[model samples]
Target: MDIETCLDSRIIHIKSDIELIDVKGQFISLAAPIRLTGQLRLTDDLRQILACIDNEVEKLTLQIGVDEAGRGPLLGSVNVAAAILPSAWSGLIEMQTLVNTPLSILTDSKQLSEKKRDKLYPLVQQNALGYVVAEIPAAVIDQINILQATMLGMRLCTEALLVAVAEQIANDTSSTSYNLQAQVLFDGNRCPELDYLKLSSFGISESSIDCQAWVKGDARHTSIAAASILAKVSRDQTMYHLDSLHPQYSIAKHKGYPTRVHMEAIKMYGVLPEHRRSFAPVRRVLENK
Candidate 1:
């Protein structure tokens, strides 16, 4: 993103079309010097120059946004994450910059296909800090219901992200009081009540920002989408493991969902230890068995 500046400290915005060439043929004022180049991608250069436009207003503001996926699904774990991105104050895009890269397709969790999620999982693993993903087993999910399970996962993510961000700042600041400020954002109608765990901050209390939960947050927030991919991949792996542990239940085929095939398997083979007894269908299957 280099800017051509022979005239130092001055910014130039070339808006009008000008023929840049060997201008011996064109009349020029002595005040204006001639400029020529063999090849110049001025437009391309301008894009980098534009990207360099960063917000200088805010200082060290971290926005920890949380979201989850697979909560409604009868299969995978309810995935959640609290992504600590350098707020708009930094002008740094979390995932959109990789438009042409392998992860260019990172977007809303629902918008992402199973295939896309699988592809982005590795990308997330490599990049995110405190990428703590908790797997909510069917037994536990059924015990607490999907909503509770999603909350549990979100709590775990919040705890982990807060710890991680604090540690990062502490290490960077050498234990100095840096006035660390954070705002929590989640893709839900309300804020996450992390009553289940004892949350602590280095010096600051958990500041709850209006989560601004969009209906399609995964598509809206790059951080949420990254969290979705992490949760989806982890849940799939858990399901695969369950398949190995209880092959007769065909956990792999249905991914622990109440599919017709899964129901038939339950009816024929009986429920496994992992089956959620609290869930009505599983309870019915057990009673019949």
Candidate 2:
């Protein structure tokens, strides 16, 4: 039996009883068939392993991932981020490896401690080929509503990322034309429809881009996870600053969420400009006053 494996550079062929398998400048000997629980499963197992490796290698390419933070916060701004990773990056980093570690810890920011998120924030930014973060303040959220605000933020971030990519291509001294065919992976079930008129300034057409929204994308997708970290960290910093200005609200502790302490502070001190007036809790407080 003959099995063929496809890789980025070449195709490897393995024949049954052949002593050697060469893949990507590496050679593996298949002369000794290993017995697993007294069952011989060398050929099938080896093939599966090689196929999985190929799949992973294929996924390590240029792509964009987007996610948002602070949508649920009653105060502070909503932050949306879009991250572009180079074609050489393997999308395998997770939140668990973000602390005092070299591996990129890419995962949903909520799953990571604040310290870990802070640690990974710079790493993500440094490794990213291009990245952009957009914030929609409380006043904007109140006017446009949270959902629209979030979508608008996403669009702006994406537009900025594309502009960055274009600039990088222009600056590259290499003669190779950078034809970046990126697929946008949004961390949700729905993405805001692109406004062609608004996107015209970025020179990006709707048809030229391929985008898809996935459920739990931040947890499942590496790029989305990185974007999650960027968005969360940026929003957290904003909340911390707001906390400094309004120490009574403890914005840093709850990060502007409608926590018990946050609600109590609203009742006692009234609302601040950072508080979203359209939010149920803030609106109720306004009604009572």
Candidate 3:
């Protein structure tokens, strides 16, 4: 019997005498059975079947998730993080499974307390397949605008992550040689225009990497969650350092966010170089002065 297949988004529709297997979020239909005398062969339809299989493979392939912190802050730098987890390791790590000592918990960084995030930062760095943290300071944010600066930070971190992955493959003798073609999942709807790096020595083409944007990806994807934790902790540490220089701003307490205390502090201490002049409150203060 001749078989026909159609796919709509995540759903797959098939018509054939053979019973079709059910897949989650996919629908399949079977047509009337037809007896055949010899081995059945698929000609033109083979291409379609192969295409569907390829789609499935891509869906299951590894992904590098990117996220940012300090974008909305009135002070400090914006931190972007790109992280890729080892395919062999699941997202969850048992309390004492890793290392001899107990480690911090893993989840969306926003869900964790400051102490918890501080502990998990080192654990994430140790276990990540490859990760990069890129920061764009307030001066740069003021010059290029926050949105553009954020996109730039994400692009830089992603490129760094690719470099790290390449280096890891070169250094690990036990690692099997494989083509790199992982999708980058951006946390927000906007995806940065990332340039491809051609590793001529390794014979890797520019098309090896793919990019995708997923809204609220940090909450939905494990890799994005990992990236979030790294970015947040790094930015917080930077804010703490800044606080040492300008103790009046109390940056460590508010972490540069525009809380009531922060606003009052800004009014009393005035603007500093670390404050984002492009932000409305800072801009207003500058304009008034």
lDDT of 2: 0.65
lDDT of 1 by residue, 124-198 (tens): 655443345555556556655778667655765665455444444443344344444445556676555653223
Pick by TM-score: which candidate is best?
A: 2
Number of clashing residue pairs, candidate 1: 2
- Clashing residue pair totals per candidate (backbone < 3 A): 2, 0, 0
Across 49-77, the per-residue lDDT of candidate 3 in tens digits comes to: 21223212322244677899988889988
Write one digit per residue (lDDT tens) for candidate 2, span 196-263. 55444444555657888978888877778888988899889888898889998888899988899999
> What CA RMSD would you report for each candidate?
21.1, 19.4, 19.3
- List candidate 1 segments past 4 Å from native: 1-59, 73-77, 85-102, 195-197, 208-210
Query: Clashes in model 3: which pairs?
Result: none
The CA root-mean-square deviation of candidate 2, after full C-alpha superposition on the true structure, stands at: 19.4
| lDDT (C-alpha, whole model) for all candidates | 0.52, 0.65, 0.64
Comparing 1 and 2 on lDDT, the stronger one: 2
